[model samples]
Target: MPPEVIERDYGCGDPSKYLRAGETVLDLGSGTGKICFIAAQVVGPTGRVIGVDMTDEMLKVARTNAPVVAERIGYANVEFRKGRIQDLALDLVKLDEELQVRPITNAALFVQADGVAQKLRLKHPLVGDESVDVVVSNCVLNLVEPKSKRQLFGEIFRVLRKGGRAVISDIVSDEEVPEDLQNDPELWSGCISGALTEEGFLRSFNDAGFYGIQILKRDEKPWQTVEGIEFRSVTVEAFKGKQGPCFERNQAVIYRGPFKAIAATYAGEGNITQGGINMGSVSKVSHRALTEAFDEPLTRAQVMAIVSPFIRRATSTPA
Candidate 1:
């Protein structure tokens, strides 16, 4: 990092350090080009790093110093853009410039601008769909408004190429943030008021069709406490890649159990989910059966692994 970069740098951890060479990285809420510059080295000259932030001053700081960082790193592969992470397809800077050319003064003008913005999103998305190999954010996702959280995660999913992943470090609440705490503007900007519950954070990734969710790190102690709620930092890694169709290939899956014991089976000529499932285990899952059943949407390979033994045994049996 350059001298100016080191001075203005801020983050919970070094998510960029995990990037591989020749990658196309998208740094969400990249504050001052520090992480983007660091990532530039990891991705090498052939790769690219795009930093997206809504703050004009921060964007200016980042863009001005981009050349200095590039010279130091021996590559000019980093670019800064104006955008909200939640709505990556809409480039606010482009919209602003367009508006300046034709300022909206009435309802008709406002409606026309909206139409133009919609066309702009489709034509020159702030971040193109499936264009990025990696998405990394540090203490930023939590700062998104609650109503926009789903959009934010969806944008992450939309930008990532299949098999690409998102590595995020941010604060999470031990419990849901109360309405009063969530309403505090200071806390919201400080990355506290809009924090998701740890479980809720994982569920969001699942909701956005990501899998292999893993927690890379978690702070040992709470960063802050609000109304008896503990908020702490955690680095989460979630991957995107669940493509293709479902086909019955003589596969079966029997969930293993030690929680409680009884047995059930549901296998037939066309419906083979073989073996005895522990019905007694129902009590253990009764509280949240439906919700937990599809928590980690298994991949095709995962399903094959679970039923491989059955397939092997049946193949070797007499016909």
Candidate 2:
């Protein structure tokens, strides 16, 4: 809402556009609080918005300008906290204040600081467990240290209620970034070094126990190119509540194998003889010979179509 926030804002996507009224929303890496402010309005007077940022300057601007937005909106329902996105329970705000009064200079003091931090986490977590309705992030998750990335994703998964979802917009690489490139501090800060590959991005959500994941948007052209590698924006929507007791839904899997085929159909159909499929292999050469008539992507899609049918069926019987 403030011009200053707008000026300082840097984001790859707007995750808050999907917010609903009366929901508790958490904005991770909410630099400048632009998304948080917009989300506050979207969530309305009854809702609450919390923005977390590790940067003092960004937090300063965000906290200073939050009241302005609240006054304009006729309700104050947004707050900013100082916490690392990867470890939300650390409560950097409280740590800063505690250290000001008594800095840790010895092993005992350091242990005391750790104890205090543990207490803060248990008693007053920056974002409580299963307390948020939605977790939104705009171009920030990649900024976290690689060692802490899995934990960061886990935090996002943890803070959300059972049915909560995460709407994230961040940069993803077409291929795996090299370790050398990842080690570069400049690239790391620029959102290039720590980016995940497209597959890795989706896998992160699945590994974090999210399901029903879908790509909402993908930039066709590279946002930046380096070493012939393309880096682009991808917005993904993933849900947190799909992990429930597995009761059979009467979904029977049908298997059709060695589909009957003429010479045309014999193409890419794994070793086909005049009598049907022989015990031969469907080499890439044969596959390409049959499908090269179409474009490459379609050829791959066709191959995928053929492969998708023979999926490993669930071990269940009819009720």
Q: What's each prediction's TM-score?
A: 0.77, 0.75
Worst 10-residue lDDT window, candidate 2: 279-288
Mind giving the per-residue lDDT tens digits that candidate 1 earns over 1-319?
6577678766777788778999999999998988898889999998999999999889988999998887876779999999999999999988999999999999999999999899889999999999999999988898888899999999999999976889898899899999999899999877889999999998998788776678988998999888899999998988776343334444333444333432221111121122422332221222122214313336789999999999999999998
lDDT of 2: 0.79
Q: What CA RMSD would you report for each candidate?
A: 9.0, 13.6
Best by TM-score: 1
lDDT of 2 by residue, 1-319 (tens): 7899999888988888878999999999998999999999999989999999999999999989988998999999999999999998889988888888879999999999888889889988888889998899999988887788899989999998876889999999999899888999999888999999999999998788775578988889899997878999989987766333334333222112334443422122333333422322222112222333322223567877876756534234334
Off by over 4 Å in 2: 242-319
lDDT of candidates 1 onward, in order:
0.80, 0.79
